[model samples]
Target: MSDASRSGVTPRRPPPMAPMGKARYRVMMTLVALGLALLAGRIVDLHVFDRSFLQGQGDARTLRTDTIPAHRGMITDRHGEPLAISTPVVTLWANPQDLPEDDIQRLMLANALGQELDALNERIARYAEREFMYLQRRMTPEAAQQVLDLRIPGVHAREEYKRYYPAGEVTAQLLGVTNIDDQGQEGLELAYQPYLAGVPGKRRVLKDRRGRLVRDLAMLQEAQPGGDLTLALDQRLQYMAYRELKAAVTENDADGGIVVMLDARSGEVLAMANQPSYNPNNRAGLDPQGLRNRAIVDVYEPGSVMKPLAMAAMLETGDLPLDTVVDTSPGWMVIDRFTIKDIRNYGKLTLAGILEKSSNIGMSKLALRLDDPVVPAKYRALGLGQSPGTGFPGESTGSIPAPVRWSSSQWAALSYGYGLSVSALQLASAYTAIANEGRRLPPSLLKLGQSPAGEQVIDPDVARRILGMMDQVVEPGTGARRALVPGYRVAGKTGTVRKTDAGGYQEKAYRGLFVGIAPVSNPRIVTVVMIDHPRGDSYYGGAVAAPVFSRVAGNALRLLDVPPDARDPES
Candidate 1:
């Protein structure tokens, strides 16, 4: 039409001659064709090459919460024997915000359970206002399923675990118990909580109206179960020790008794037992008194049994010799009006003789020998009064007062094992240095990465000599007559002390103590026995605690398959 219009309509513009509506239709068709091609490709992927992942995503919505309840690892003994294990049980938990009270209206009473419905209701109800709470723990699987069937609003059955102790009270003090939370609470359980409790994982997915996962989760973390725990306790030995202590406590009418057995060479605690123990399953019945696990927790005047440690300290320091004699007669010695007395007197006794006779005055003399700042330095070296550095939770370190401020009376009293308090575990562990040829390896409840290539606490020769002296203490000396274990040469000492009270030292209260090593050629165990407040007659260590020692030692040696020693019962 016009020259300018013609140039504007050059070949590049295509002149817009075709129907505009038709061109729009062509573009629409092209877009529709591309979309169809994409759809076909997706369909091919869904039905063929990668159908599982996509189909799984769709299935996740209905079955999203599929879970696997992994078994908690078992706690085994050093021998790979089961000490504690997880037994599956159903725990009842509820979303308190949605639960109806009618679901748990009453707790059914089962004689074995020991709890009433009313009590159950109260315990759970206390936490009911909270969003989440445990309604019950460790219920039977069948009972759990029944509760689940009720399908009460917010009421759900959670599968959990209950700790089962195969040896029951025999290993209770060491294995410990867990709370309702399926968590470890005390003893070894507390010690290994982190490693023994596993990492819990989670997954999230869309669910259908029926609560089944219909689509695969965008988030799925596979749960890793807990690692198994191995303990240092020997179940059989523990049971034997427990039985021995229980029998002795009942027979002696003692207020309480403690028995500790140590692996003489390794310093590993083989067994530790106390009387008046409660079944862990019924922990609610445990009294503060009953709950007092005395082996590690209790500290008392160790009496004459402490002489060996004191004597070992002096000998190891090369400051005192076994033949060094001290005058210990008159059955008493007065230092500044505070008299230190022997339960029985020996006129003149060597350091070894003092321990053999269990002479308090004799041990007092030895403590006096070491009373020089340089002497009891060996006492400090032996780890007395310090915590055993043992890994056991709640263990008491015991007390050894600094002799730096030693009053004559305190120093004298400390000599014969009064004023200075020691735990059975500490004493046992310290003796390990002697039995281990003078090395004090840190005691442990778990296996060590490296054995306590330990610190030197004594001269090897001195330790050997001490062992021999201990043997004689059980052979023909004061600690002898009662601590006779057939077939083994046992070496140890006896101690009898007036139990102190809040008012003052109890005039009549006594603690009978005995500590010994067996198979003297190569000591196997360091066993210590302590009996408190023995009633009626025969309260001496030789009379009360020694018999306990004899029974425990005899059984322990035999159980260990220790070869018989050269000892004549008649002799």
Candidate 2:
């Protein structure tokens, strides 16, 4: 007490204990309890009831949901040779927000990305809000590795797949091509996209601050790989056809060309090729014209090739026999204002001889003698003016004028294949019916385990007679004599049609076409070759297209091990 008095007067006496009251103690205790209860409630709510919010906040910075890519299906030939494949590739990307701010660091990154520094900076600025941007897509693994070696921050590489065509330009027109995202763009690839495309999967994963994957959380969906497509194509036959067709086009200085080979018995497309093709892998300067599958998409007047179908129509009437004679004296006949003529006058000839010589006037007279609907009906039944149902994109169904509206000249023009148009594929399919004994089987682009039932378009007897008549077309002095293969009896028809322009038909331009079947005795394969606007010494089908057919058919037969049905010419 004496020391307190000396320090301060107010400290002399300690204030009497002012809070000995129970009510104040109870009130303080109650306030402390309420504060503790609120704290515990908030903690429980955060840990249990509202835990998702906290979890989401954490995941926003450290977790990502990523796409698991699925590879497109492999396209293989009938014998399992790869035609189209998916190769593993790398896609280099960057996070603009996390990219180095230093200009020197950015310059290094640009050099690694093969981009100008200014351009890289501009791109980053444009996509600053976006955390991810593609720096390079579809890069080789080596290139991606080189990019990763730079050790640039915010740069990343992801696994992807690129579509590659092993056959290159050889199968380009038939197999079509895929886009950067592996979606089909043209040809059979587009037509069968559903079957060839895969279902992508999804997964969640934890990532570090630097955006590297730290742990896989869960798989949201399983990826379904696309089903492999086994096409009816025979790679050996395809190569042979492509080589021969390309050679023929170059030799003739032609505009373009197409070659189609079919299994006569099974109606499966063995090989289909087009000239002016492009490499599907590199499409830097691809031409739209070259992208067309000319065999199925381009149509032209079949010229004299329709004569055999006309003859078959006449034979079906039971009034005209294979030996029935028609007089063609003047080499030309007037139909309205137009004149139908042959290259030379053959005074009188049987129906078979008419086809052998490709006599336009003779065919015109035979068509006039028949009822109006006969020829058109026969053509329709043979799948003319209709799609072959091969599932090829952009396939053309050629035009066929109605028979009821035909004038005398129109009917005559129809007889020699002038007014109506037909694709090379349609011509080959029609010839296939003849080879298959009047049974018109549907053409297929996929491998067939068994031969499909064919519709009977003509009587088997009539079909056989027509086939025999066509056989003579490959004999000496016949139009398509060059279509013959050694040790094989080839039957076929030749067509030379004038190319049409904006005004009308062009006199100098012609489409030379030959449709044939090999080993006439067995008729195993049907092949059609078409050369567009041949500018060489000859533009006739026999001279330009027949040789291509011969080479392709001969090689295909040998490769297939088809037995020779006739004595070898040398033997």
Candidate 3:
């Protein structure tokens, strides 16, 4: 400052400062250029050469491939009524490592999830070593949404399906149930699993830091919807049968019951129901017995119901005629030291009279005339002693002693319906031969477009003659009179079978059964009702099972619009 004040021109003169030294300037410029080059190289490497690695690292945190759930198939009755369906549900899951460390956030999450705080803490601790854990499964979307809205770290929502049964216990045993993962576990559901469970899908999506889906990027696979299944069940008829059968079982105070109604022409199962059924939709504390489809799985002695087929066999041998008569003065006979008795004696009875009175002695005489194998052969020919071919799981092939060897007592018992076991379904199917003019159609659970060509198991004339004789069993007002319908001709047989134990037959336990065809002039439906261990005053098939048949048959015929055909319209 003093120098400038002293000399006025001093500022201009003091110096044109020398330019920066060349080497130092060059070194500084070079250093700056080198730094910029390194930066440029790094940018190029990140955008091109190392692009995948950098992008992959970023994507590891934000992008994810997720599973898209598939909806299971719908099961409908023959008339397009819903029976079983799949409803949308949500499942909550978590990544333990990504969970919030704060206790407050965890508490909020536990409350929203409807879990006890202690339990949630225990669960989280148990799975701390695991990256993935299921928090809750198969929750309603509304319920799961509440938990998801908390935005708790590591929590996620997955779309899933839960099976819903529309018919509830009405169709439980038949439709069966799926597992927690929606895989079929029993019944027709198990039979048709591959056809019902559709293929799942995959998709790529972007998520935020908190694991919330930001946007869908691309579909890796398209989900395939399951195929729809239409069964041969008539829901209306099924309800009717179920109601009538349940009422009978309750009124009789029976242990259990089964009713199988079949279309005689098409062989489609119209309605099959069992007592003590469980709701498939909710199966907590379910008794395993409630899951049995008793119609197709349980076998018992056919009792007196086997008489028609036996008589048919006798006629087929040309050894007896419909007008043939037998003497029953004593009311009982001894075959191999075993007594075969009738309810009472009618002295001499014609073949038609024998059936009308359900004469055990008369059938015994006819059986004595035939070869030992004749009656058993007739049963086997009529679809007994075999699976009914209904595509059901655990279908039983009922047992019959091989005709190769036997006893006179056994043969005589067989003629009157004993010494052999048949399922309710097999019995119903056997009656189809008598109802369908000796043609035995394979039983079906699925609907068919037309009636199948059937196997002829007996002479059409023999079947017709047998049907003619059974007409008297109902019309006489002596046997099975309770089975009479208001405006239809009914004909069938009743059976009261003594249950067998490890030792022998039980005197107190009896199964009452009835198999019948209605409007005997045309014979459209074959219905079988079986009540196991009826404890009421009467356990006779004519008393217990026939009334159930009358109710179910009357209602079913009207529902199908089959016109009434009784000679006296109001009886």
Candidate of highest TM-score: 2
Misplaced by over 4 Å in model 2 are 1-44, 568-571
Candidate 1 per-residue lDDT over residues 390-446, each given as its tens digit: 666788877777756677677666656777777888888878777778887666666
**Candidate 2 C-alpha lDDT tens digits along 1-571:** 6876788765445657566676788899999999999999999999999999899899899999888889889999999999999998999998889888999888888887789999989999999999999999999999899889988889988888999999999999999998988899998789888888889899999999889888999999988888899999999999999999999999999999999899999889999999999988889988988899988888888888898887888888887765678999989888798877789889998888898888998888888887656887889999999987887888889989975667888887887888888888888888877998899888888999999888899889988988998898898777788888887899899988999989998879999989898889999999988899999999999999999998999999999999998765687
Give candidate 3 regions above 4 Å deviation.
Answer: 1-63, 101-103, 208-211, 569-571
Candidate 1 at residue 58, lDDT?
72
Decreasing lDDT order of the candidates: 3, 2, 1
Q: After superposition, how far is residue 253 of candidate 2 from its true place, in Å?
A: 0.9
Per-residue error at 363 for model 3, in Å?
1.3
Off by over 4 Å in 1: 1-71, 93-135, 150-155, 205-219, 316-323, 366-371, 448-451, 476-479, 568-571
lDDT of 1 at 205: 61
State the local distance difference test value for candidate 3.
Answer: 0.89
Residue 466, candidate 2: alpha-carbon lDDT:
87
lDDT of 3 by residue, 1-571 (tens): 6877877754555656457776788899999999999999999999999999899999999999998888899999999999999999999999888999898998998888889989998998999998789999999999999998888889998899999998899999999999999999999889999889989899999998767799999999998978888998999999999999999999999989999999989889999999979988788889888899999988999798888888988998887866788998799888888988888887899988888788889998888887547788888988888878888999999988886668888888988888889998898888889888899888899989999998999899999999888887886466688888888998888888899999999879999988898879898899999999999999999999999999999999999999888886365
Cα error, residue 190 of model 2, in Å, equals 1.3
TM-score: model 1 vs. ground truth: 0.79
Could you tell me every candidate's TM-score relative to the true structure? 0.79, 0.91, 0.89
